[model samples]
Target: MKIQGKTALVTGASRGIGRAIALELAQQGIRRLLLVARNRQRLAEVAAEIERQGVLVVTLVLDLTQIVGVNIAIARAWRSYGPIDLLVNCAGVAHQAPFLESKLQNLQEEIATNLMGMYTMTRLIGRRMAARREGTIVNVSSLMGKVAAPTMASYSATKFGIVGFTQALRGELAPQNIRVMALLPSLTDTDMARGLQLFRWVLPMTPQQVAKVLVAKLEKNSSEILVGWQSHLAIWCQRFFPSLLEKVLRIVAPLSLSRSKSFGEIANRQQATGNRKGFWRIVLDFGFFRSNIQTFDKGFDQGLKDKFPD
Candidate 1:
């Protein structure tokens, strides 16, 4: 469908890929945008930016994890600005940690925000779209959805769920003329990914590049949009060489875990929590497997370093 002159509701619109998408939509001459996120100030900032492009902007401070609250917010937005032409379910939370080290609270937060929140928003807007018989829904999934990564078990689970959900919704909504699509982007240079320790050769793209690719594909009736060559390659690897991919992941699992631990430590330090021993705690918490995994990771790390010396 044509993006120009369409009213779009974009969740997680305060920053990162969501922010980029909203701006892209504006640049494409979108009539209006309802920006939903927990950060009201940031939403206002984004609104101001979009306003400069002459697109009407509405900010809705919403915490997607709260089902009732999300429902209420959507209802209010709809009442105020009738008939959403497009819906972008992009609000999500991601946390990286080994399953053993992951806090239950953090895991729950990820599920509530990334999965349940999206499901709720999709269902609500989707019903209206179905009734109207014309609308588009874009669910921002991730490359991790196609291939689970170590130290991101919970996050990958949610993203994988999104892929399945989008597929099912597409089938159900197609007859209604309500388009449903999933966008899978590789590691992006967003604030959310700033703390992640990238693999040796993986290149991260900017959010703007991802947004540009996705927006350019909006007119096409594609079921899934892979933002970069990396995402396409990763999915291809999973499809044609599952076992080889598994072996590669296993080789990097220990390094991924260390990166997660390091990121957590950095976060703690930034918050001035002074938890200097957190890294050792992560190491010891895994028990007997820790040493063996570290040894395995060390050999592979050295090999990679030799092959791709910086």
Candidate 2:
């Protein structure tokens, strides 16, 4: 769909990928934007920036985990902006713990925020889009959604659910002329990654880069766009060599376990005083997987160049 003059609602717009998407949309001349997130102050800051760009901006303080709040926010956006021309479901959370030690609550929270919340929001907005017969929905998924990773079972499960959900929604919405697209970005440099203590790998794309790719792909109504070469490799490996992939993951599992143990120590120390600070301390000390990022970035850039080859 053409973004110019369109109205868009973007969840998790306070920072990271969502923030980048909002800015990109604004740059495209999408004159009206509804920014949704739980932090009112941050949401206001984002709105201010977008408004400064000379576009209409609406900010909604919403905890997507609360179904009622999401519904209310959708209603408010509809009342304010009329029918939403685009809906970007970007709010999500991740928690990493050993399968045996992970609590039921943690898993449930992941499912609720990442899976069910998207389901709820999509159902509400999708019905309106169908009725209008003109809209676009972009669901931000992850590489983990395609491959199961050690200590990220819960995250992987939620992402996998997104892939299925987006694909199914795409098929269902095809007849209505409303496009449903899934943008599967691999490790990205974002606050969510910092919160999850996942700084060991090189993130192939910055949030801005991912946003650029997403906007370009959305223009074409692509069903799914995987953002990085590593992601493409993971999908291919899973398809052609599942057993070898499992063996390789087993070999690399120990390094992941060691990192998790270190994070667990920090968690324990902080828990004693109810302060969960210094969780990212290890990333600075051990120089995060910068080489991996360079490698992935080079591959991604080369692939893009080859495909576009201007």
Candidate 3:
């Protein structure tokens, strides 16, 4: 699909990869953008940035967890800004904790935002897109969607759900000339990435890099856009050497557990000291935090980089 002159709606447009994608789309000549996220201030900020690039931007301060309100907001935006030609479901939240230690609320919120939110937006926006018989939807999943990690079981579940959902939509919507794609970005340098405990060999990329890849994916009309070589390699291993990947993950589980504990400790200290940041925000904001093992995993990092040079 031609990105220029299209109106795109991007959720989670306040920060991180979502924000990057919005700007990229604007730069690519997207005529209008409906920016959706909870933070009105941040959304406005992003809107200003996009507007400066000569693209019209409208910010919707709606929480995806509030399904009814989200629907209403989308309706309002449609009424006000006209039909959205492209939809980017990017609003998401995650909580990093071992399965045993994960709180029920955290799990529910993760499902609500990461999985259900995408589903809700797609259901509503997709209907209109299908009616028009021409549109595109991009669902942002993660490398974890393909391969689960320790202490991030629930997050992985939600992301995996997104991948499946996008795949299903691809089949259902293809006949209507509506395209659906999944974007599986690895650890990107963002606030969200900074909060996560990552594996030894994982290297973080900038959100701008992800935004650029998104444009390329749009032009190629690719179904699955894996942002980094690390993601590509991981998925390859999962398909051809599943047992080896599983074994490596098992060996790393204990380290992941320790990282979870450290996160818990930090949360406790923040609470005790009355830090402005919420405990779960700190605990769940594991964007690209290196696993302690990464500090000493020189050969693993070097070998992977040598194989897949930047």
Candidate 4:
């Protein structure tokens, strides 16, 4: 699990958490780094940055949704870097539409990108790792993977699948000396959240912050690490008090919908204005507000713990 001088492959490495993770690994002395994403330019940019740190970086612009392309990309990476010591499956997408209104294509894409892509990449590199009897796999999952939410049914399903996949794979691969870890992050500030307004109230940490925790946990070979306090509480609540949690969610559903509507409107207005600055300003505001909610939720949990003193 040691990162220093290791060869690491990070999918979705063009930006956000993937980019941060790639950089983190490089900083940890992971010399042979493979950065994968659909955008060649961005991938090259990341590669340049990593190379500045004196690490050897390979950029692959391959759409992971394509099964054949993914297999080819894995083969190319292996040829270039030999057996990958660490594989970080970070590529993902989210669709926010009501269940009844959701399109089949959108659902298919989510499953293909979020679930199947990870499966494909893991299987390819995992086999190599097992043969070598050394490696680590980190799947960047979400808190929604552990609990469901309105309008995010499809997204949540994919995340839930990831959770299950990682857990089962961990059990299967332990004997092979290949550690499978799931890094569950709450909402995070990234382009993926750009079109979603309701997420503004969820206030997520920056990708860099989440990446720091991810890398730290990987070093310790932790099986799963929940990112935020609210995330931990959400998992515990769903597990220990499902009835109470359901009632609370039902009461808050209307407010959540209203927030989503408002956010969508704001995003549309910003788009109409064609003001990039204004668009990002709104995003920043939303991120901050969401972070506040996460803080409050965590504080509430702390208060409960103080009262119970278990």
The regions of model 3 sitting more than 4 angstroms off are 251-310
Task: Tell me the tens digit of each residue's lDDT in model 1 across 55-113.
Answer: 99999898887889888888888888989999999988888777888899988998899
Query: lDDT of each structure?
Result: 0.82, 0.78, 0.81, 0.81
Model 3 earns a TM-score of 0.83
TM-score of predicted model 2?
0.81
TM-score of each: 0.83, 0.81, 0.83, 0.82
- Candidate 4 lDDT over residue span 131-188, tens digit each: 9998999998898888787678899999999999999999999999999998889877
lDDT at 38, model 3: 91
Model 3 Cα lDDT, one tens digit per residue, 174-201:
9999999999998776777656654443
Better of 3 and 4 by lDDT: 3
What is the model-wide C-alpha lDDT for candidate 1? 0.82
Please identify which of the two predictions, 2 or 4, would achieve the higher TM-score against the true structure.
4
What is the Cα-based lDDT of residue 297 in candidate 3? 58
In candidate 3, the residue pairs with backbone N, CA or C atoms under 3 Å apart (3 or more residues apart, or in different chains) clash, namely 192-287, 193-287, 193-288, 194-287, 194-288, 195-285, 195-286, 195-287, 196-286, 196-287
Give residue 144's lDDT in candidate 1 (0 to 100). 87
What count of clashes does model 3 give?
10
Root-mean-square deviation (CA) per prediction: 7.5, 8.4, 7.5, 5.8
